[model samples]
Target: MTKESDDNGNTPITGDEKTSVPADLLNIEKGDVVDISSDDALLMALGYKPELKREFSYLTVFGQSFGAMGIAPALAESLIFSLGSAGSVGLVWSYFLGCVALIPVALSLGELGSSMPTAGGLYYWVARLTPTRARALMCWLAGYMNVLGYISIFASTIYGATLILVAAIMIGSDGTWQTTKYINYGLYSATTILCFGMTCVPSGTLSKLNNTYIWFQLAMALAVIIALPAATPKEYINSASFVFKEFQNTGFWPNNGWAFMLSLLTPVWVVSGFESSATIAEEASNAARAVPFAMVSSLLIALVVGMGVVISIAFTMGSDVIAIVTSPLGQPMAQICLNSLGEKGAIAMLVFLWFTSICNCSMLLVAASRETFALARDGGLPFSSFFRVLTTNKTPARAVLFCALVTLAEGLLMLVNTIAINSIFNLAIMGLYFAYTMPLVSRLIFNEFKPGVWYLGPKLSYIFAVYSVVWMTFIFTLLLFPSYPNPDETQMNYAVAVLGFVLVFCLVYYYFPKYGGKTFFHGPVRTIDEVIATNLQLEEQLVRKMTEDRAASAT
Candidate 1:
């Protein structure tokens, strides 16, 4: 484990603080006992009660995460934004490269989530992983970053989905339809309302919804993978030479290498949000095993499928890269589909993208609301009681509707200048990853990782955790770099400014008298005796089940 030293050169965290298990409790090694108390005991040890229903199985949780990333839909819509700096080789390679770099980051999250299954996720992990003196302050910052990140993710997704649908509308109109600013706003309103209503439904039905979307995503991606290439005309099909050797820098940037490097954001942005399962860990049964498995497996699935679709697009995107990106239809993917496939086939593809986007939007709303509800439950946000309230079926109904509405409201930025919308989307990658890297670094510093159902040995785990910090540092810098060089005021990247305001706002809010001054604002609260008692009851029930099983076998 890595260590930090003070000016005197002695380690700050002494021997007692090294182990995370409570000192008062017996030191029961994880996985050595059949106790029903592992997850709950860990939570109680960290001062939280297990209130969420543990109904989600491993596959169901994986389905939720797979739908959340919306990998195919995300790439289809965002590729146009990177066209100036990317060609066929650059486009497809960047995605797989980013996925490779992100594996360690995701695995780090898997390790942390397996050890601590909490709804607050990264922020909660930070609280438990850091030393006591710095715990509250660091946890507070991590929570704020996570909350703001998802809100931006929600807006960015809805906006992208809206554009895909709007492009379809224009296609069907045969040049008569125009996507006005208000039209974009209308689509955003409709999507927000639809997703909000769905998320507020009973928690049981939410699982069913995830199941449905998971299949839809697979079918749509498969259709595109086979159909698009088969339908492409011989003349329009790209050759191996063009696919692997071609290069384009039509955006007029100063450096082609840097421009290509920064264009990787398109893939990084699309492949992200795999951490959704970790955020929803509180709802999953045996989360220590399930959450990490769901996170790692979902990304692996997306990588294979997403790469296939990207390669297919690279092979069949047509000979005219310039025309496809600059299409008058106001949607690049829609135009590419039209040029590759005929009108009927193109319409069919757009319809597929539209529904997939809806599925993606729904998943994002579910995750964002749950995160918001968890934060509010811990008194991290305003009106904590209101946002934390669950419905008859244990769903965060109010938080779901409230956060969805706010994200839609932020979509009003589309009217000001469509280009600026990049800043909002960039916040999702920057905020979530920055938040993600913090806890991993903190864990290494404090030596806080404990063996769980899913264990990685210390040497290998520390290597990934430390590497993730370095990778995120580079990504953090690259995300803020201007997408278009020599930009006018309207074209400038505003993510740095907007993210700065958020950081300052978090600081101001933390220091405010009524908010952080209260008992709720303290890092994680201490577990009450009630939590331990409840675990004892649960343990008794497990014993009863085991006894019944043995008796039946004997009979």
Candidate 2:
């Protein structure tokens, strides 16, 4: 049990689990001991010291993930577009069945969560799993791709909620109060401000609110499921409609693989970022176990509860669903509620949806801020120190506010080209899932990874990993094609250009060194070894001091 000092007369870390320290803070001599027992030590093991507080519990962690899913609001907003593309029955069945494709992704991602739970999530894994020579480039690409995805989801979510809120106000005024897109933008900015407020709170407070959030989501969904059906006139409600009736597509897309695939986006979007749990792993008290389960269970909750809610809305939406989808109110869910529940009921329901959407926006901001903070800590972004700064409350205040500002900027773009904005939002899918696939691909190809406390068995894990890669590749190719086809009305697949911009920007950033990303960009700094070294030196110093005292006493 004797300890030896390193060449610098400091502790030499023993054992295979040891890691090197970050360059900035390696000034330690013999007997210089540092606490390496807490979660901050875990960050040190990954080459970063503890910056943000770790106070999130299992429920708060789960609420954060589930809130990101925001099942009911997502279903409410996307239904009109999905139905327009594939009709009522088309979206219902496609989404239900599309769960098959997503199951493999969720499982595979959860497996990764068990292995490398980091705030950087996939990109951090990319740096760890990829070959030493290529790790920096790939990590850079993954980081940019993933952040853009988070940013897009943030903006799109708040914007959709804003539309619903506006529609509800108009409906309450009996369709007399008209508003402009500027009003919508203003609401979007205001919600972003609220989201920023939530992000500024200390860890435990958000966890408590998120605990309320997940339950509220479930209660509201169940309320709608049972109340809507019970109150609707039996003559107006039809089981056959939900199960089999297909509404006219009105030529949004020709009935083909493309149309069905496009409709699949509705459900896929609902399930897209289940990986949010992984991104916030640093805050979770027991990340390895909690992140994996949270990622999978949130989606399962969404599928079981969200699907039922969607089917209920469809059945009670009345015979003229096309009219509902194409309503002047700009919210199909609001119109559908008006049909089933009277005016008072519709307004009340819409208000609840708006409230939940605000919570959803805040949760999304939390995820994005964590990811931004992680990337900056690794010196991946310009002004890393600024984004990486933690407030007195131990929250990433600057990072979260930066995300809100970016969301506002994106909303401003909507004023320029309303139709192409779909591309910007769709990046949430294209960017994140693509970033996700990279590490799994490297692990599969390289066949090297250290298992965590939680992991799938060897054989099944590889199969699912390979499946994730193939599935993401397919989705990417499909995104290249236009959603509604035909070169008219500027409804182009602007996602292609957005993706191109991401690629180009990351490429440019990778080569430019003044940004300081060029040097020391390798992933997973040898954090464990540094602590072990310090401890070893401390033990040696203690031994030497005891021997000196004994010699003097003997004399």
Candidate 3:
């Protein structure tokens, strides 16, 4: 267990010499007694001490991202956006192309995640990948964008859950009961609180629940895919031509081409939270390997399964896209389900979808809170110390509460105007992709890019990184456009304005005054010294134990 000191009176560890220490008189000798895991060592090297419990194995980590995507329910939540834009053909083809185009983005994320897996996600990557002179400013920009996106995701998903709940209630009531925005806001608030509570459980417990829920997601998706075709009357089912070739545009966009492109938002929204796997890297075992593998694999699975769900719906969702959108039930998917499955069956399906929607909110909340905690840990946010505090069970309770409060406040926008709330929700998708763009751009411009265990190597990595940046920029531009060419208040898209406000806030906050990020923040702070100190203490304790053992044996 002991290593012989070199002539310089220092003993080196097996992995990194930086972890070596002096081997003098009063010191401990045993290295085997303190077996540091690779995960812990790597985390230390990344300037952290593994504060979060590494409870999520590869499967559970994969489940985290997969469950966050909430493929079946998320598709249902955004189906109207696609179905209304280009009918069944747009619904199917747009999803397929959008998913195909995003593969490079996902691959680029996997590369960065593998190289530098941390809960800080994109911002940490930005800090490390950029030059020292620009590190703090770029880090601030990336961190705020990432955390804001996370909060927006939690709010939007909870809102989607609210919609599902209201739809379920109306269907259960046989469409006699009506709902308003006030009712919707109340349900959304309750669901947000409920998800925050769910996310406050011990990390181990939540990981287990996520593991179980991933299968539930698959089962529910398969059930709908199968049951939709089985339950739909032959008269209601559309033919292959109608499913694949029909183009219906209700928006005021210039042409059917633009309408089809607009449909891309649905898949983009559905796949919004797949990066959640990276946001939990600190809590995942073998994170560098697990995070990348989980992220790309989950998206790949979503691509196929999501296609199945959409195509199934396109065939069985009936011919009237406008009717589905304008249905009295207040949800497009609910109306489609009611048409295909009837009242009782639709209620059952909606209830299950509602439950999964809640789980999706919780899953997204976990990522959001972890992201907030990471940024706060780096002294990036106001009251950083407070939000960085973890609960007794090693969960980010304060960050969870902070995110929940933000979600509740953002939900108030629904009361002001529906379009305003929609802008905030759309901001989630735009802001997240904006965050995603920085690290890829950094890797491309900086020469310090390093590959980890799951890398795509030199040429392929550059290829993916290049494509990802180009594609994300194009998509972000597309996202800023309003659904219609000419629009009134309700039809106007304000997401661009929202994004501009967020950017201004970040710029102002970073350089405001003595409390600015420039004053205290210096990228991610290193805790490696603490780790080394703890190891030295443990080694000294072992030395004392050995001395006592020898004395006792001699006596």
Candidate 4:
């Protein structure tokens, strides 16, 4: 290979076959520079040069909102209440089953994350590992499902926070807690806005904020485990075992076992957001390892801590648990805290609960935006280009803003009626389960036999995958039914609202092709190498442009 300096004092390297510089040093000739090598072109394409960092602490990996005590206790109480009598046992069973099912899913995700760690997480994995024909649709659906999950999370957090606040006032004062329509709506709106505003902070700053939340959760967990138990009357502890063999209204023994099984879905919803850690893979240091560990660890902690607290509270309260859960006051956990700990202890618990809600909201915000960005990156949604743009800070600013707006809109819907709020909640849960089922089904039907970098050893993976699908499908069906016996028109209307949304989604999907529109899914798997190549090509282009400008200026 040989290269010579041009008249402008720039050297161009060439193969052994040829090339020379002009003799005149003052004169320069400019021409287009063409690189024949694909590798070289690819290196020129990728814009940013990200240096992988090792800044993540182990605590940071596992210490997120999913494990928070405030959220978990509220969630447990909600499930217990929704399940009623016979439903309580079923709810507990479902929770355990869900946790067990997560083991294989986590193992699979860990392997995938380890191999190709990206911020998009599962959708990114789908794009890289699935056939191209299916990539767009899979990505789009994943994005939708991810957003749904986050929205539900946001709503739940606000609901939990509001309950905590209400609990504080009621427990502190001698008067009954007032529950006016305007007051409830105002609380939801305020919390939603607060959470949305908090998300607008820079990513690095947000990370630090989340770390603070992790500590808050720890403290709250300790307070619940220690303070609440110590303050309760010994007599109150003995009252927990008085079982109601029949419902006063329904006269049904154990209050319908099937209904109880259905009620378990509420708890599943509460403990469900652990996957948010994986969704922020792009932002995390060493995400491949960190995301998976964070996800699985969060779940384990939620299980251990959540069940422990619930059981402790249950054993202490005895028969009062049912009365507390069924009360019109409507916030069982807060009621329990107040009943057991009095005013000061209740306030402490409320503060912790509030903090946990904020933490969970933060995680949801991040997860939702990432899903929107990931879908846009794959050209699977409208205004894809805008959504795909990353700010100088390397965060998806537009997507974040868009998600915030949607959250605000949903929050506003709460003012319409309780039915509307319930409807939205049910729809969100349905969307989440629908999303979860798709990937599991896709894996089972299409990629079951395909070996890749991450395999759960063929037989077991397939078996578990099958089990997951069945479990999800069963739960999905049951979730459509209302919990209360002989539900009022409002409850029926809520069910209709949820179903209506699904029908709309299906109809839209059906009509997309009628106008000669392209379907999101196309064929072929995209490897990690492909994404790297695309990024590198952009980088090389920038470098080449810089080099050419220098040469021209010298001339």
Considering TM-score, which of the candidate structures 1 and 2 is the better prediction for this target?
1
> How far is 329's C-alpha from truth in model 2 (Å)?
0.6
lDDT of 4 by residue, 379-477 (tens): 555576787777765667777777776766666655666546655555555666676666566666566333323456767767776776677677667
* Residues 284-338, model 2: lDDT tens digits: 8767778888878887877888778878876787766678778888888888888
Query: Which pairs of residues have clashing backbones in candidate 3?
Result: none
Q: Tell how far residue 65 is off in model 2, in angstroms.
A: 1.4
Clashing pairs in 2: 11-537, 19-526, 19-529, 20-526, 31-537, 31-538
| Better model by lDDT: candidate 3 vs candidate 4 | 3
The residue-level lDDT of candidate 2 at 196 comes to 89
- What do the candidate models score in CA lDDT, each in turn? 0.76, 0.74, 0.82, 0.56
**Candidate 3 wrong stretches, greater than 4 Å:** 1-34, 530-555
Better model by lDDT, 1 or 2? 1
**Predicted structure with the largest lDDT when compared to the true one:** 3
On TM-score, the stronger of 3 and 4 is 3
lDDT of 1 by residue, 1-555 (tens): 122335865233221221232322323445343333445545554566555666677877898788988877888878775664677766777888888888888888898888888888888889888887788778888887888788778778888888888888888888797878888888888988887887787756788888888999898889889998999888778887887777776455767788678768777788777888887787777788888888888889898999998888888887677787778887778887887887888888888998898888888887888788877877777787788888767788888877886787678778878777767778788888889888988888888767555667788888888998999888888888766667788887777777898898777788777655233577766534553454554434333433333343346
Q: Estimate each model's TM-score.
A: 0.88, 0.87, 0.91, 0.76
Show where candidate 1 strays beyond 4 Å.
1-42, 514-520, 526-555
Model 3 residue 300 CA deviation in Å: 1.0
* Whole-model alpha-carbon lDDT for candidate 3: 0.82
